[model samples]
Target: MLELDGTTMCKPGPLNPSIRAHSSTLTNKRSRRIKGCGALWGEIDHAQGVPAMLLISIQTLLRGALMVGGVSVVLAFSPLPVAAQERMPMRIAVEGAFPPFNYLDANNKLQGFDIDIANALCETGKFECQFIIEKWDDMIPDLIAEKYDAIISSMSMSLERRQKVAFTEKYYNSPSVFIARKDSPITDVSPAALNGKKLGVTSSTAQESYANHFYPDMKKTVFRSSPELYKGLSDGRVDIILEDKLAIYDWIANTKAGTCCAFKGPDLVDVTFFGEGAGIAVRLDDKERLARLNEALKTIKEDGTYDMINAKYFPFSIQ
Candidate 1:
């Protein structure tokens, strides 16, 4: 006879002939189950018969552990998303010598139509802008070297310029005009009409290019700057001076040199010489910044800011 001291465990009783055979088979099955448990679950004791609830608990623990392990592995291998970066203040380059477009006042501080337009663009773009005065000759190279982010110095949009940098839509366009003393009798602008006349133009400007290309027969004198060109006209060094119509008009109304001159015949503008018009220039690689600038330009033009600026500088529309 066998007895369980504290637990209510089942016990085998005495058996007759048929019951003895069944008892032997049941004992054999119990031994096999115990052996299987020892092999797969060595920590579980099987001599007292395996507990059904214990097997359920083990399965639940194993499944939970596997789920946690899988989640940890995925988290270790996966990459997190990165945040967007903010842009720095943009540095804009302008030619201080170009008046009406840009120039220095009596205080030597930069002020002009170009400067106002630049400020408007920056304000509309929601970005801080700093204007730096640079020579027109070195503007493109300096931009490529990252010295400045853009040029708003009345730079004409040309195929030759597009090779090195990108340009926004034309901000302004004006026809080139010839200026002569009101007393001078230079009326016709035809090539044949000005055969013996001497023409004065700023060097490296569209006026000079036009003079050389179309009126090669006329005597041409090139000056380094606008003041020099006007000086040549006032001094009688040249019979007629070709330049931007609006700029000359401003000079005539404001400066003493312009007082002696008046428009000779007609306003001349050819895309080959003057290009599409003056535009803001940026480095070719900076497409994103250029896009922002273009957007800002459109915003200002549509918001009445552009018209206000035009009214401040001129009695007529220059847009």
Candidate 2:
């Protein structure tokens, strides 16, 4: 039996038609053993042990195991050994460099939407959360390989991605916008106009698909990170870059990447190349975690917490 620590259990992935385990899934074998004949009770007090005991009880109940007044749960073959609830920390993967959404602050501490929301989710889910800065390129592969439990990077939920990994409810959304040299001889760049132009985009992303589908004749250069893509455009390696409008505004205001470049229309929306805005990424097998995330997301959105977080980073309403 493979022992899946919380870290190795849930990996990041895109929803796909052909589903792979992505990683070793914890069976929660439940260790169903014949109990004290029927109602063998262990420490079932929530205050004495860890809150996680509640989960064990819940799991046992869901498996057709009976609950004995919340004191001891009746198992099919259980005088359950009832291990003390362990509040172990959960491991998370993130692109620690994306700004506003999830980035390393001046203090070297991770700060961003994903970071904040991850923490909030941990609180709600009652699991310790640790974030690892994984590259965008490797997020899905490593996640499927069981590198981490979840990815809180600014990943969009789209049909293409859904084919590979499962996504939580959308948390943030921004439309796509074209970035070009401010003084370039272009008003509105049409797919035809880009026939021979060098266009830079994030490789293997919806952005690439958008360009390929819309402007097949246009030359496309794909970079791994936003900074790289921005640099490619600023250095004149590429004529234009299509990216999120919010990110574009941030780059233009914060760095010289936007100094000579301006966002050219037609504008980009969630449905464009980026698909839908940001959401949490998890393996397809994590039904519990995915279901939990959706529940928490619904609660946060209903309580206005999500909107508050969004307002702190983005002023304009993109919904």
Candidate 3:
């Protein structure tokens, strides 16, 4: 008699002296037992009382049996080709609120540079990839919790963040800048120039860190998303906002609300706050996946695919 357990196989009666009892845990976390039948049939001698035909049948049965909630269920088994088996799609997380980089369209479909870049990398690498929209503040935490495999969001590679996750080579680089109403008197972003004015920035972003570090005395209003932060500037709730230059440029050139605001000062390039640039993020232990992404990034750039995507969003090269 044979029995299947979640991780071990057992025989009820005495063991056969001729055949040594053996067991093994399968990749799927299930195990099965036939008295004195080792994990591999080749190890068994035909001279033993057990027939070769019977042993082959038992092996087939063991492969098909699956344990579910303490009950054994037999399922039809068909092995797929190695290539077909390796085609499983990797899950990628993106914040669907950052425009020009990534955002939801009027149709609510994800569309932007990050989306295009992610698609290109996956295609060049022969990897199937799926994108999941996630909150900005929750991106890192959820990634660590295994909710997704990697983050292709425009996340800056700052030293503070490197303590938790690893980043691939930068896909794009843009400087931080300040935006304010065209009519506002604040021509300079110096903290002394705008003593009592309200400043807006998205929470848990590189821009926020920059503002907190450089303009610690300025009154700051933190928003949950980029759209909300932009709205705060337009609605007169905030006197100015600090954000990615390319993103602000896209708003000023494309959206109606952006017409009320304009770039306030020169580009801010403090590396302490902005880090290097935006890169894909994965768990610290996922070095193999990181290498695969870096190779794919190189392939796309060398093939002109990355240039094509960049031109779709910005007139100037951000790389």
Candidate 4:
């Protein structure tokens, strides 16, 4: 405390007895206050009539309190405001080789049923989005890890997968079938015809499921992709390939083996083996994002965009 010792200032300092005594008194008071506060900062008020250090300390405390309070509020409401929600380009994953569902179009673009539907969804949901190609087998694991925000590669809805990822209602319907080389002699075949022959299918797919369930007598050969399954048939490694009907028709129509193979027999998709139509796959944790995707899917299906996407790929409706 820099006290203005008013009683001692008027006394002369040339060995004046009263002046020496007053100076001693003032020193005592300053020492007492400094000992109490452990600071010379609290002495400023006595000299200047107001303390800048005290005001600064008070301001710092208030600011710190506000910071803690703000953190608590943010923690309590993690749902950020629209602007605060991190603005990121939505990434949609696709199985790049699946023609008409999401193949590399002639122009080298991801174009197909899934691609168009996903674009419309981004537009309706007001988000910037991009599509990236990935293998089908990696889709679920990648999606769960948030490698992409969603997948729109004609992934089907099943009770098993539903336990892992969220799905929209059916986007479009199609059937599954088998493609056999015309010379293979399996085209004129029955489900029983595959009894001893090796039939190829994509692993973990509806085709694989149907093949195992319906043709339990056959040797089931599973590959990682539909193209690979077809390749196995082409190389005579497998008698035929079981997969999506439209995929078979499209590939056979577009390839050198066009004259060599065809989709033989009726559609294997009877809800008994193949589940309902395909839908977009989303992470299970993103309730908000999932809701937006579902709404967009519903709107497109109703306003005929989805049907148009259907017409571009499949010729007949699934009953």
Superposed Cα deviation of residue 228, candidate 2 (Å):
1.5
Candidate 1 lDDT over 175-293, as tens digits, reads 88888988898889899999989999887777787889889999989886676788899989999989988767778899877789888887786887787888999988888777777
lDDT of each: 0.67, 0.64, 0.72, 0.62
lDDT of 3 by residue, 108-215 (tens): 456788877876666555444555666677789877887666898898899888989999999999899999999998897787887778999999999898888778
lDDT winner among the candidates? 3
- Give per-residue lDDT, candidate 2, residue 111: 67
Instruction: Tell me the spans in candidate 3 whose CA falls farther than 4 Å from its real position.
Output: 1-85
Better of 1 and 3 by lDDT: 3
- Give me the runs in candidate 4 sitting further than 4 Å from their true place: 1-89, 105-108, 187-191, 254-256, 270-273, 315-319
Q: For model 1, which pairs clash?
A: none
* Backbone clash tally (model 3): 0
Models 1 onward score TM values of 0.70, 0.71, 0.73, 0.66
User: RMSD in angstroms, all models?
Assistant: 35.1, 12.0, 18.6, 28.2
> How does model 3 score by TM-score?
0.73
At residue 64, candidate 1 shows an lDDT of 41
Stretches of candidate 1 off by over 4 Å are 1-87
* Model 1 quality (TM-score): 0.70
Compared with the true structure, what per-residue lDDT tens digits does model 2 show for residues 1-319? 2122111222233222221111212232222110110001222122134467776866767776465777656555432222342322345776655676766555445566666676556544544444555556777888778766678777888787887889988877777778898877766678877778889987666777778888888888888767778889889999888776776677787676568888888766647457777788899998767766776677667776667777776677544
The alpha-carbon deviation from the true structure for residue 17 of candidate 2, after best TM-score superposition, in angstroms, is 34
